[model samples]
Target: MIIGVPKEIKDNEARVGVTPAGVRALTEAGHKVLVETHAGELSGFTDDDYQNAGAEIVGDRGYVWGKSETVVKVKEPIEPEYAYFREGLVLFTYLHLAPIPDLTNKLLEAKVTGIAYETVRDRQGTLPLLTPMSEVAGRMSVQVGAAYLEKEHGGRGILLGGVPGVPPAHVTIIGGGIVGTNAAKIALGFGAKVTLVDLNLNRLRELDDLYQGRLYTLASNSYNLANATREADLVIGAVLIPGATAPKLVTRTMVSQMKKGSVIVDVAIDQGGCVETAKPTSHSNPSYVVDGVVHYCVTNMPGAVPHTSTLALTNSTFPYLMRIANLGAREALKKDPGLAEGLNTYQGKVTYRGVAESQQREWTPAADLIS
Candidate 1:
């Protein structure tokens, strides 16, 4: 099998699909790896590193896309790269297709076999591939939120961890998953008052144990969510619904009633955001004032810290990549039920129920095709 790693072209997205160490693994397994020139440069992996790992460095993205049987990526393919899509090509990446109708249609039209890293499940039903980046994004959400809370950044002029005479800022996180947990960890580390809400009572109890009662864990309901957001100095929208679009937990009206100059870091922005006002912002311009509240909705927050993100993401994703490469996607999917869940599209049909229902498209079960 020939695998291609293209440099991520999304705005400020510096993570590559595979590191040199990953390439070495594939190469050692008798697979040929082609890396786009400098694809891993921003991630601290040099082209020479790839060469030493037995990967051939291609000069351009087009060559890498055209030559490889399987094309791996950090982010979904943007519009310009859409033209490179070919029939029977295997695309393995974080394809958040539920919110991107165009990308979904393009993959179907091109008959590409699309595998989404975000949808891949582990034996325990956890999203293993998406977990690392989610952790990074979740942790970064607080860091960015605290920065944007300063008066210079048009925030409420409150410090996350206040001085001796002042009260600390209040942070409300809207989920109890990986993102919410990490956000709370960082927010509490800054001495900010933290409130985490989730629908699962057991999960909330687990979080209580994790935090040792340091943060408030509320049952997720309309009233609790609204009241929390209304009183929050910084609201982190961390809700997720797997491959589906994130549920909009914070309404525009709720946002408008929040404290003036408050900040919202919507970590769920990649899945179309849990805040009604969030529109994807780029790293070049990461935030905007919405109804007197600042919104940090950068779709690729992990991309800003490519070195850590690339390593963390590749570490979790490499085993699956090795499986698919060594056994071929078809056999690999048939052999592993969890990996089969990653199949968003196979041939011209949508194979993942979440993406299909979210997009209002018909889907074929992965089992049917794999069998």
Candidate 2:
């Protein structure tokens, strides 16, 4: 199989889909890898590194896309790259299609096989592919929020960990999943008062015990969420629902109620955000003020730290990529039900139920279509 690793064209997306080590693995398995020139430069890998790994360096992005049977990418195809879409070209990437109907339409119209990393599940029903990046984003949320809290950055001029005789900032995380858990860990490490709200009481209980009661875990409810946001100095929206849009737990009224100059980092922005005021921004323009509350909703938060992001993401994704390259996408999906869950679109049909329901489109099960 011929695989393509195109340089990411998404705004400020420096992470490459495949690393030099990944290319070496594929080449050793007798699969050809076509890497666009300097595709891995931002991620700390050089063209010589890829060449040493037996990858062919191609300067033309179109040639890489045109020649490969499967295209592995970090982000979804942007508008410009949409022109390259064709029948039977397998696109394996983080396709956040719930919020981007245009991309979904293009994939279906072009009959592209769209496999989303976020939707892929493991044997334990966990999102394996999405976990590493989620970890990076989760940890970075607090770090970014802390930076945005400084007075110059349009924040409340409060330090995350206050000095002696000064009060520490209050951080409210809106979910208890991977992102929220990691956020809470960092917030607590900063000596801040952290409150986590979630729908799962059992998970909250687990967190409570995990933190030895230092962290406040609240059952998710409108009243609880409203109170938490109003008191928060740094609000991190960490909610997720697999391939679907995140529920807007924090309403516009909640934003209006927040203390002036408070910062909001919606890590769930990729899934349309859990905060009502949150919208996707880029690293170039990462934050904006809404009702005097700062919102940092960069869709590709992990991209800012390309080296770590690429290594972490590719660690989990390479195994699956190898399987797809060796066995072919259809056969790989057929053999592993977990991988089948990753199939958002295949043969012009919406194969993922969550994306279909989010878009109000009819979907055929992947099993049915692939069978």
Candidate 3:
């Protein structure tokens, strides 16, 4: 099998699909790896490093795309790369298709076998491929929010951890999942008043044990969410429902009612955002003000730390990549049920229920394609 690693072209995206170590592993398994020139430059890996690990360097993305059976990428294909998609091409990447109708239509029209890293689930129902990047985004949400909270950034002009005789800032985080939990930990470390909301009682109980009364946990609802937002200096929208658009937890009305200059870091922006006001922004211009509330909605938040993100993402995705490379997509999906869930689109049909429903298109069963 021949695999192509193209340099990510998403706005402010610097991560690549594979690293030198990953190339070496694929090459050792009798698979050919072709990396586009300068694909690893942003991630601190050189073309020489990839060559040392047994990968051929191609200067043209079109040439690499045409020659390789599978195209491995860090982000979704942007407008320029859409033409590279051809019939029977295997696209392996983070295809958040439910939110983006145009991209989904393009992939289906191209008839590529798209394996989305976001929906690849393990036996325990955990997203192995999405976890590493989510962890990175979750931790960075607080770091970015804190920076934007200064007076000059049009924020609340309060320190996260207040000095003596001053009260700390209030931080409200939605969805007590991986993203929210990490945000809570960081917020607590800063001595900020932290509140985490979730629908699951058991998960909330576990968080209670983990925090040991250091933070507040609430059942998420419209009333609680709105009330929390009014007093919060910083809000982190960390909710997620895999393969579906993010639930609009914060409405336009809610945004209008929040305190002036409050910051909202929507970690769920990739899935269309929990905040209704969110529109994807680039790292270059990461925040926008609407209704007196600041929204941080960078679609590729982890891309800002390409070195760590590329390595971490590849660590989770490389094993699955090898499986498909060794056996081909049909055989590999037929063998592994976990990997089959990753196939959102195959042979010009939509197999993922969430995406098909979102687009009002006909759905294809995964079993029919893999079986």
Candidate 4:
């Protein structure tokens, strides 16, 4: 099988799909890897590194896409790359298609086999491919929020961990999953008063015991959410619904009620955000004021740290990529039920139920199509 690794073209996106080590692994398995020139440059991997790993360095993006059976990418294909899609071409990447109908339509129209990392489940029903990046984004949410909280950044001028005789900032994290959990970890590390709201009481209980009651865990409700946000100096919107759009738990009214100059880092912005006012931004323009509150909803938060992001992401995705390359998509999906869950589009049809329901479109089960 011939695989293509193209340089990411998203706004301020610097991560590459495959690293030199990943290329070497594929080459050792007798698979050919075509890496576009400078694909891994931003991630601190030189073109020579990929070449030394037995990968062919191609300067033309079209040639890279034109020659490969499977195209491995870090992010979903942007509008310009949409022209490269063709029948039977396999696209393995993070396709948050619930919010991007245009991309979904293009995949179906082109009959592309679209496998989304975010929807891929492991044996334990956990999103293995999405976990690494989620962990990165979750931890960075606090770091970014803290920077934006300074007075010069239009924040409330409050320090995350206040000095002696000054109370620490209040942080409200809306979710208890990987993203929220990691955010809470970082927030608590800063010595801030952290409150986490979630719908799962069991998970909340687990968190409560895990933090020894230092981290406040609240049962998710409109009232609790409102109260938490009202007192929060920084709000982290970490809600997720797998491949579906995140529920808007924090309403515009809630944002209006928050403290003036407070910051909101909506880590769920990739899934259309849990905060009503949240919209996808880029690292170039990461934040905006909404009702006196700041919203930092960069769609590719992990991209800012491409080195760590690429290493962490590729670690999880490489195994699955090898499976598709060696066994082919049909045979691979048939063998691993967990991998089949990653199939968002195949044979010009929506294969993931979450994306289909979110788009109000009909979907055929991957089993039916693959069988």
Candidate 3 lDDT tens digits, 33-138: 9999999999999999999999999998888999999999988888899899889999999999988988988888999899999988888988999999988998
Q: Alpha carbon lDDT of residue 60, candidate 1?
A: 81
TM-score per candidate = 0.99, 0.99, 0.98, 0.99
Query: What's model 4's lDDT at 221?
Result: 96
What TM-score, to 2 decimals, does candidate 1 have? 0.99
lDDT, candidates in the order shown = 0.94, 0.96, 0.92, 0.95
Candidate 3 lDDT score at position 292: 86
Identify the superior model by lDDT, candidate 1 or candidate 4.
4
Choose 1 or 2, whichever is better by lDDT. 2
lDDT of 1 by residue, 1-371 (tens): 99999988999999999999899889999999999998999999999999999999999889999999999999999999999999989999999999999999999999999999999999999999999999999999999999999999999999999989899999999998999999999999999999999999999999899889998999988898889999999999999898999889899989999999999999998889999999999999998998999999999999999999999999999999999899998989999999999999888999998899998999799999889
Worst lDDT window (10 residues) for model 2?
346-355
Q: Model 2, range 94-184, lDDT digits (tens) per residue? A: 9999999999999999999999999999999999999999899999999999999999999999999999999999999999999999999
